[model samples]
Each structure stands twice: as C-alpha cells, then as structure tokens.
Target: MSLGRRSVVTLAAAVLLLGGCGGGGQEAGAGAGAKVTVEWWNIVTTEPLKSIWAEKVKEYQALHPGVVIKNVPIENEAYKARLTTLNQSGKTPDIFTTWGGGVLKQQVDAGLAKDVSDEVAPWIGTMTPASLQAYQFDGRTYAVPADIGMVGFWYNKALFAKAGITAPPTTWSGLLDDVGKLKAAGVTPIALAGKEKWPGHYYWAYLAMRIAGLDALEQAAADHEFGGPGFVEAGRRLKELVDLAPFQKGFLGASYNTPDGQAATMGNGKAAMELMGQWAPVVQKEAGKDLGDDLGFFPFPAVDGGKGLVTDAFGGGGGYAVGQDAPAEAVDFLKFLSQAGNHREAVASGAVLPVVKGAEDAVKDPNLAVVARTLASATGFQLYLDQAYPPAVGQEVNDSVAELIAGRKTPEQVAQAITATAKSE
Candidate 1:
C-alpha cells in the first residue's frame, strides 16, 4: 500500500539513490545560536496533512528562532521522481519523507541516511513498536514514523445486508461464500485498480500472510526465494477469488483514486468491498460519494491450515529520515513533530493514524477507531512487500501478481518471477 496515496511506477527509480545530507553543518543546532536552514522534503500537497504539517513546522520554528525550516511540499508521484534524481546525484534534502522499509535500507546501505538510533533513544520507546519496525535495521533506527496503518476490508453495510450476509466473514471459506452471495445479489463483489498494480498485490500479499504466515513472507524476502509451496498456494487462492469475477467491469484498466476508479467504485456503492489501507474512507469521500453510515471495516479473513493468524496485520506508514550529515536541529524538529501533543492533531484530523502511544484516542471515526484497536493488539505485522523488498524485487512482485490476475501467468510463474528478481537484486 502507498499508505494514503496511490503509488506509481516512477517510484521504482528510487533504487538508484546514492547521497548524503544537502544542507547545514554539524554545528547547526539551536544551541549554536546561529542561523541554520534545514530543507524538509515531504509529500503533503493535499489537505489535512498539508495544513497540519505546516502548522507543526511553524511551531517548531517559533521555539527555535535561529533555525529556519525550509519546508518543500510536493505531490506524491512527483516527490518520488524528484527524490530519485537528487539521490542519484549523491545529495538529499536535510530531512525527507521516508516509507522506512527496503527503500530506507537501501539508502542506509548506500550511506545516504543518518543512523538516529541514539539521537532518538530518549523518546523512541514512546512510539508504538509495530510502527517502528519498518524503519529499524540491524538494531539501528533510520527514520521516525509520523503515521501508521494496516490493510483490511472496507465494505458497505447496506450492500452486505442486501446480499443477505448478516456479518463480515472471519474465515477464508466464509469470505468466498460471501463473495458468491454478493455476486448473486447483482452487486460487484469487490473493486480493484488493476492499472495501478500495487492495489492488486494486496490480495496476493494478504493471502500469503494468511496461508504462508508472516514469518514465511519475511524469510522468503531475506532468503531471495519466493518460489515456495506456501507462496504458490497464496497465488492459487487469489486465483480462486479472481475466478469469481468479483471486480467491476474495466477493473483491469482502472486507476485507484480517479473519479471512475477503484475507490470511486466502492464509494459509489457499485461494489460491496475493497481491500485497502486506513486511508480508504478519506480517498473514497474525495474521489466519489461518501458511503457515510453504510461504510464498515473488518480484518482480512484467516486461511484454514495456514501458519498466519488474522491478527497479523500488513501495511506501512509515512515517516521522516534525516540525511547523513544534516544538522542536529533537523533531528530535533523530527522529535518535535513526533511528540504526542503535536502528532495528535494529525490523527484528530482523520488524515493519519497514530504512530505514537497515547495518541490513539485522536482517531475519532468509528471505522478508523476499529483500525486503531486492531493495530493496538496485532500479534504480527508486515510492511507492504513493495516497500519491504528491494526496489526491483518489489516491483516484480507487483508485476508478476498483476499478470496472474490478468490470466497471463500462473501461480508458479509468478513465484518464479519474483524469486528471480529477488536473487538478481
């Protein structure tokens, strides 16, 4: 998942990064009592986060008059492209947005990112552990999470009732049965953005999590071996759902947040459910009609005879990573941003989910509150595979899985493609 925004192929170019901090010096701390400018790059060109982040920056600056926070807000896809170019040239903004998975790991490996394990030590524990997983590597922290979320089913209650389904399914078989019911009732069972390959991968990823287990998925990524029985079975299971013709017409070419895309389809009530992250409802309201009280959420169903439990959540969130040589004040600003009081505003706006402990109450939406509760008790967690694996390997997972859904590839072939790419990487 893109966490809150739709991802694009341009992000794959992120693999080319090789850089260090771009502005300020080691002496650029507030204590120095000298003017220091820290360039902050982020994807917050949209509302809620856009305005909220600006306010936080203003607050941070007011507290340290000597420090000038140069905030650079860019659109999501454009930000990736710009970052890729900067990174390829051996330079990065002082403090930049990060997804904190394989992408951050690559920057860490290339000596581009700062290792803030000690810098953040004092208050790092104040964050939810699951939200910090993606940013940690080999016992070191690379970034600080500003928001966190998990992927699950967002459905329409009225549609379910119309289909004669009394409640959401908790098991794989039950889910398939519900799909049958929805289809028989003449409702599109699910909405998918096949044109945006990332959305389709959610199904395969969740299925692998349910059937093969979270550990298996992690081990496969680490071992560069995805052509295992468990993974293949995950693909086969997804194929079973695909065979049901569950998605709307033109789904294979549909976008994610466009007016006639996946979110719109579900928001308009043409489809009963969509497997999306915590950002679904907001995007639905933006791209189409808000389902209002008709909206509901549920955890992905558990697979029979599988190693994973329903409590194993899968998703990732936004965070900030300081460049290798950025000013210490840059790190301080990140801390200020993560503080419970400051972060709560973002959560309260319903623009982001809580990453820090004690901010959970900020999630006021009924459905979002359910997500927060689920995350609080999650037994295991997996960041989105596209962000967890190397850029090439992750793209392969999306591409191969999309092909499988399009009837252009078999489960075994999908696994083989991903395994080959992983090994090459």
Candidate 2:
C-alpha cells in the first residue's frame, strides 16, 4: 500500500481537478458509487507522526476501497511558503491540515476553505467546548481537530532520581531549586534548540503566561500592548533563565534535529527537562530510545504573584479540512475521514491527543494519555502565538524571539519591536 512519487503526483492532479470542480451542491456523504480522490497534505517529517500517518492512510484506503488518498508530507520550514504558492495558483489540495485558531480565520475569510459546520456538528457535543471553539471562525466551523495538546514540562525521571529529586516542582522557586540540583549533578537543566526559533519562542510564551496571565499574553500578541508591567517582568524573568546557562553548551546554535540526535542527553539522562508540547515523546522515540519509565510531565510552575493559573495551557491542534472547490467525491472522502472511529484511529497511531472523546481512553501510551487528561481538564486554552496572530505579525514575533536568543536584542527592544508589529497590523 506504499504509494510512489508518481502516484502522489497523479493523486495531486486529481485533487486539483476536484478543487476546480465547482457548482455541484452535492452533500459530503454522497454514495459509495462515487470514487473520490483526496489530496491530503500534512507536515509530518518528524517521527511518530510520519509513521502514524502512513499507517492511517493505508487504513483509510482499505476502509474506502474506491477512494484514493494522495499523501503529501511537507517539510515544516517550507509548509507555509508552499501552501501560499499552491493556494495562489489554485492548486491547493482538496483536504489539508490547518491550525485551529485565528489562523483558520484567514482562510475562512478568503473563501479558501469549506464551511464544515454541518458536517462536524454531530461530533460537536462530544468534544470539549474549548476544543470546538479552537476550530471556529465567526461562529462557524471550518475544520475538525484530530488532536488536542497542551504545553508543559517534560522531564527525565531517571535523571531526577539520579539527582535525588523525588518530586516534580509545583512552584517557581521549587523549579529553580530543582534546576540548581540538576546543574550540580552535571546535567543540563533544559534541552533547548534555539536555532529553530519557535522552540526558544515557547520559553517567552510560557514566561509571559506565568507573569501576566493568559489574557495579557493574548492581548499583547493580539493588541500589541507590549509596554505593560506584565511583559517587562516576564522579559526580566526570561533573561534570568537565559543567564543561568540552563541549556546545553552551544544550544543557541543547535537545531531541532540536534536535540533529536542528542537523545541520550535528554532521554538516557544528560538533561533533566524540556519545556515543550505533548509531542515530546514522539521526538524522544525518534532519538532511538523507548523512554519507558524514564518519562514524567508537569505543568509550568506558577509565578509568585502572577495572574495566570496552573491549569491554563498553551497549545492547539491542526485538523483536516476540505476545499470549497473540491469535487463531490473528494468532499465525501473528507467526511469519511472525519468519522469518529477513523479520527480516533488516526490520532492513536500518531500518539496525538485525540479531539474525539473516547479516543483518550483508546490511547495505550501512558504519556499520550497524560496529555489527553491535561487537555481535558484545562481551565483555559490559548493557541500558540505564532498561529494566533496574522502571518506578518507572527513572522515579526518569530524574528524578535530569534534575535533575543542571539543576544542581539534586549528585553526592552524585543517587547518594543513586538508592540510595533502589533500596532502596524
């Protein structure tokens, strides 16, 4: 069932035709007599997801005998650029993965996506309200989330034990104490790959959340009010962390691929922890280790007087959505893929937090189940800032974070630059 490059190209061409075939108001559940060809594009270069998607695609083909799925795995760095170009050329895939927050709003407004409200409504009541809201634009649904994840601290249990640390820290001061212990034990406290920019940017987002609360971070990113006391304090705290050398040597120059290779450093026992999304386990697996019994997780520690709550999570899922111009058959295939069972299967294979309710129970991996539980119990959820803001503003924030990490910009300079970008938008 492994599809070749030619098959992929052929499927993409069919998807293009399906996308250009407009004016037929056929429903998504059209009969099996119609053979649909769906061009499904996703960014899955990393492990677990890539292998998971490959399996899921095979299952989808078996279930829908007449349906042909064109799977295109886009590189993370090139996804946005290529997507934009494909969209402009009117060759956008019939069904593609998309972020579920304000990012989807832009596509909805541009009429690039189909309103899947009706198609997704049946499963709506089964999902968490926050999960449902993440995919909404103007009170209408444009996509169905396949996974829902939360950002938190992922630590190596073996490393903690070696350092004689018995429990995970629940407060800010406790976190610093643990970091000090790990540092004394000759272990890097955090594994940060700053060259990728977004990973370093995550530190800022979490710090901002701890200092100002979710509302302030949201407003600052959305409204550009970066001069507030909350932001300044967050920036100061970030600088303190940076000064501590919590990260590995030469971390600033290391890429995401570096962390994956340095698996022994983080997974076997060299690093104590990483502040990352729930997807860290997959990354660890890619590093050639099982990570069994050595993994543990905890929410980010609370800032002493900050307004943010420990229950607030920062992360969102991307899901598959059909194009408005897609052919009737392709649209039908998209709907088939959204069925509860299919969706759950897809998520379970990917080790992703499933958007469907029962899928959490279906998760065999304890780590993934922990992620699901966290997402299920979160009091509030915020999409990643880059995915929450307009593309231009997001790009500016990414660059600012990169410069901040490189020591090329002061905290004040980064804050001011972010505010300027928000105001200009």
Candidate 3:
C-alpha cells in the first residue's frame, strides 16, 4: 500500500526543513570559544523513546560543557532518504544512528562514515562477539552498537490464560496447537499489520531462518543462492503459516496504525499475540494500555530437525557512527555519549537494550531485560534483510514479499526476484 498523504506531507516537510539547514560547516554554535555542535539524527517514533533520546542528548551536553548536540528526530522513512542524500552530498550529520551490516557497509564503501575501530576497539572487547560482528565489514569497525533486539512473540498473558494455554509454545506443532486453542476461544491468533510490508516480511525472514538455518539464509541473502533445499523449505513453511488463517481478517489492508485501533482486541484480550520486535512494550504504552501483567514474550517456535534452534531470532539493531567529515569536537562529543553512564541512561529511559556490556544491569523493564538476555545468548546474528543488502536489492525483497502477501506472486516468483536482483547487483 502507498504511504498515507499525511506521512507523505511529513516526509516532504522534513526534507525541505533539513535541506534549508544548509550543507555541513560552521553554524550558529560553531564560533571562537563557542561549544562544538554535533548534529545527530535518529528515527524514534514513540513517546517514551523520543523523550529518552532527548534526555540523553541533554545529558551529553551537560557532561561535555563545551559540546552541543542538535538532535533531529526524523520520521523513519524520511530519515533513510534524508541520510542518503546527506551522505552523497558530503553533508551527513556529525554522528547518526545506523542499522548494522550492509547498511553501514554501504556508507563505509562510499567513505561517508569514519572507521571508529581505534576509538571503539578497547570497549569492543566487552561486546558480544556476534553483536560486534554485525556492524563489522572488511576487517574495519565503522559503528558502535547502541542496542541489540530480537524478533519474538509478544503475547497477552491474560489472553493466553483465558485460552487455557499454560505455557508459551517452544515448537512448531506446539505453536499451531496454541493457535487453534486461541482461535477456538474467539481470539485472533495473531495480530499482523501487512500494510507496512516490513512487518509481513519479518514473518517470512523468521520462518526462513528457522527452516534454512542462519548460515544458509545469510548465504542466500548475501549471495542470492536460494535454490538450496533449506531455502525452498523455508519458503514452503512460510507459505504454510500464511495459509493457516493465523492473522487477523483483512490484515493485508491493515497498517501499523491499525494496531492502535485494534488495541481493544489485543489489550482487552481478543488477540492472543503478535510476532514483533522488542519494541512492542513501547508501542503498547503509546496505545494507552497498561501492559503490566498482560504482557509476556517468548522466542519463535523451533522447526523439527532444523539446523538452527528455537532460540535463534531474526532482527537487527542500530549503532552510533561519526561522519568522516565531522569536526574534532563532534568526534569528542560522540565519545562522551559512548561512555557507560550515558548509554545506561539511554536504556533506562527509552527501554532500549544497550550494546555495551554492563549496560543491561540498568534496563529495568522486564521485557527489555528479556530481550537483553536473548541477545546476549544469541549464537549468531542475521541482519534484517533490508539492512543486510544494498538499498535497491533490499527494496526488491520487500516488494516481492508484499506481492506474495497480496496473492499477486508465488513463493518461487518472490525467490526468483530476489535471485535476479542479487545477480544484477
């Protein structure tokens, strides 16, 4: 589906506003004896996270008396487009948030981002090897992780209880069984917002990971070799789930905003669960629901004899990176924000999982804590497809998945589109 008019207007306004801000150079705050200004951009849509990030910037400025931070809160779609323009024009922010893997690699290749290896290596020793590896490319580290998250089932505990599901499912059959029970109890087995496309794509990616294993899926995404048995099996399994009537009715027409309208269904116990990222709690809070006792989380169910275990998750987190053209003061400001105190504050206030070691101790929310533990225990990390491939190729994958969901394309057709893009790239 096309973006709403309001969204289009907002994106246009953001681009014009940012464009009028002029190319990178000295601004009002950059003068003799003035504070060093660092422009930082992020795509945080929810309330608590928005405030938390604002607070973090405030705290960073306080710690570095002579440094200033200009926090630009851009809408998600606009943020990517704006950053791309800035990167190409050599006017990117001094320090900005970036998704792990190919997203960062693209900027690194274009020489828009700085190699922060020396600046972050000492602290890197404390990071999970897999987490560190997610942002690394060609033996150089270009970004420092801000958090790690996982894709899982975020369910309503009370709904599960009312449906007589005593425990979360750990296997494919168990999940299907639970879905049946939930449906029989008049609850929507799953809440899916397919209009966004990415949310629907998550289902396919997670299913692919479960069926094909991390290595094979990564190879497929990286090399476009989806002809392997594991890859085909993944497509078949995802098709099975799609045919199960698991999603809410008219899901293909539902947008992320639909969840808010359907809040009563989920929050009032009409829907059992949603397969989503760790940010569900944040979304719940924004929807005006007291998610206290109702919320519970569990990893996606396992596939029998699958090379990967049930605990393996499919999601990507972001990190902070300084622009190569940033001034010395901007680099120093980035260093200040990376300190343990600032990072912890960001997590505690925003409910974000910290990328640094010892930062988890400060995450108070139960769900965030669970996410932190899951990420820490992860044996491998798969960068989200959109973030793992070049933007053009990533768009093809998303488009193919959307077409498949709309019944305009088959699994083989989608897989072939992906392979074709890989070959051309």
Comparing candidate 2 with candidate 3, which one achieves the higher TM-score? Answer: 3
Q: Alpha-carbon error at 386 in model 2, in Å?
A: 1.8
Task: Report clash pairs, candidate 2.
Answer: none
Query: Clash pairs of candidate 3?
Result: none
Selected candidate, larger lDDT, 1 vs 3: 1
Top-down TM-score ranking: 1, 3, 2
Q: Estimate, for each residue in 286-326, the C-alpha lDDT of model 1 and write its tens digit.
A: 89999999999999999999989889899888888889879
lDDT of each: 0.87, 0.69, 0.70
TM-scores for all predictions:
0.93, 0.81, 0.84
Prediction 3 global C-alpha lDDT: 0.70
User: What CA RMSD would you report for each candidate?
Assistant: 2.9, 5.9, 4.4
Candidate 1 ranges beyond 4 A from true positions: 1-21, 26-33
Winning model by lDDT: 1
Residue-by-residue lDDT tens digits, candidate 2, 81-136:
56665665544567776775545666676677789777656556676655665667
The alpha-carbon deviation from the true structure for residue 93 of candidate 1, after best TM-score superposition, in angstroms, is 1.6
Top TM-score: which candidate number? 1
